[model samples]
Target: MSRRRPTVSTSPSWTVGDLTVHRVDEIPLPPATGAWLLPAATPDVVTGHDWLHPHFADAQGVLRLDSHSFAFVLDGLRVVVDTGIGNGKERANPAWHDLDTDYLGRLTSAGFPPDSVDLVILTHLHADHVGWNTRHENGRWVPTFPRARYVTSRTEREFWAGYAMDEARAQMFRDSVLPVEEAGLLDLVDTPADGATILPGLRLLPTPGHTPGHVAVELTSRGETAVITGDCVHHPVQFAAPAVGACVDIDPVRSEASRRALLGTLADTDTLVLGTHFAPPTAGRVVRHEGAYRLAPVPPVAPVAPAPVAP
Candidate 1:
């Protein structure tokens, strides 16, 4: 008699051939003010991008900026991108301070355990992106993915060496990044100029601006492609006005240029896009509309379950 294996499911997923991408969102935060999250997110400004309603915003026009983590499983390897602001992290922002989201549990329920994750990618070293790299253990931060090799850009660490001040950054380095390094699990690589293919189908797409070494993770399987947009462009509002950057971007000017260039490059292509901080229905494609770019979300893909691994 054959034994049945235990199973895990992460719906809201998209697959191409052998690769599967699942959205494990962390929080559904209230809409941040335009002056802070994005000065251009003002009522009048967001009003211009009328497409934002129903999905990206509420009836009152408040833009939603949720933090999410995507699980990429292929060929028996589990790779998680952009760990969201993790549980019990002490952040500078009131909203992020001491979070308790069921992020890790959600990841576990989705089929990939922290120990089972083979690779963890940090597109940049922001507090939100790197927070879950470690978790609180024995009154000290410890690597969450105990058996995974954490990957990040060498340039990003160099920048943090000089800029690791302020309450937020200092805290992140102390809690999230340092612990991972202490465990000897952090692997630094060059910021790929055009997505140096790290894995068989995964590449690092250099799209800096929000941070000095910000890069998107590009996945290609059987000739189809999808790029995770890190923090290069925060809100879809940037789709219509790429120049309107967030208050948190270290170099807003350079970030805008990077966003515009990326949008232009991906406009009307077959490549799917997954925004690091986009609201639900996060996967989309960039298209030119009325001389401006907009995201046309890939019609939602139903969740599918595969055979479970022997525990």
Candidate 2:
């Protein structure tokens, strides 16, 4: 499960028409072997895919899922979709418990300082996604982006408000989620009937089921479209086998349906995709590979432009 990462640009930027998007990474997780994370993502299947190699999966067929975030800069607004796992926390999972990283520094490297963020969206308040919503401060947790309005669906916040089934979930809610609520910066928004338009070009599309109210952030400008997949579909292996649900998915059945629908809408189109947990060169387009689908990673040198997706 060792991840031998190659040297690559940490902040890989994308231009979706006028809006600029940057990938800010937190941690490069060690590879998960043979459905350790997804039941159908076995070594044989991963090795056979061919397309996942050297990017999603290694030469030996180990899968690496990163905890990362996307910063979208449009007009005068700087919004971050899904903050990566933050430092200093207690968790049932040892890898994520009591740790530290240069996530904030990388955000600054991506031209987004903590204070510069106007809005921070929690796609769903999972440990990895919402960890950076707050930070440890003087024996307490505080909103990391103090000036930003931390946004989440009312359904999501309300569901997690009472989610104390396990110690880790309780601690995560305590340290990462509630502080934003206490700060008076937590904007519990209702998912719009049409779509939640944060600004003119950016939208939040409700693609629930990974969590009760998970959302995928969409960016559209000057006739181009891009989507930030927030756990709707995590690893690219799911692209070829949509039925393979993640262990962390709250409702595998619902998550599978959501994944299929999301892929159906995105397949063989110009819409650029940025996976929340996809490995290096994370941005790409969904294309029909044989009969199934695949996340053809956008080449680091130059992306292959596909046909314009219908708006």
Assess each prediction's global lDDT (C-alpha) against the native: 0.82, 0.81
- Displacement of residue 162 (Cα, Å) in model 2 is 3.9
Model number with the top lDDT:
1
Q: How high is each candidate's TM-score?
A: 0.94, 0.90
Q: Per-residue lDDT of 1-311 in model 1, one digit per residue for the tens?
A: 98665564754677755678888878876666444788767777776777877777766667878888888786668889989888898877888889988888778777777888889999999888888899888888899999889999888888888873877678778899999988899998886576666788888978777888888888889988888889998888789888889888888888998899889989999988888888888888898987888888776576566435435
Kindly list the per-residue Cα lDDT of model 2 for residues 162-253, writing each as its tens digit.
66558778888888887888889988778864668877887888877788888888899999999999999888988998898888788889
Candidate 1 off by > 4 Å: 1-10, 33-35
Estimate the TM-score for candidate 1.
0.94
Q: Clash totals for all models, in order? A: 1, 0
User: What's the lDDT for candidate 2?
Assistant: 0.81
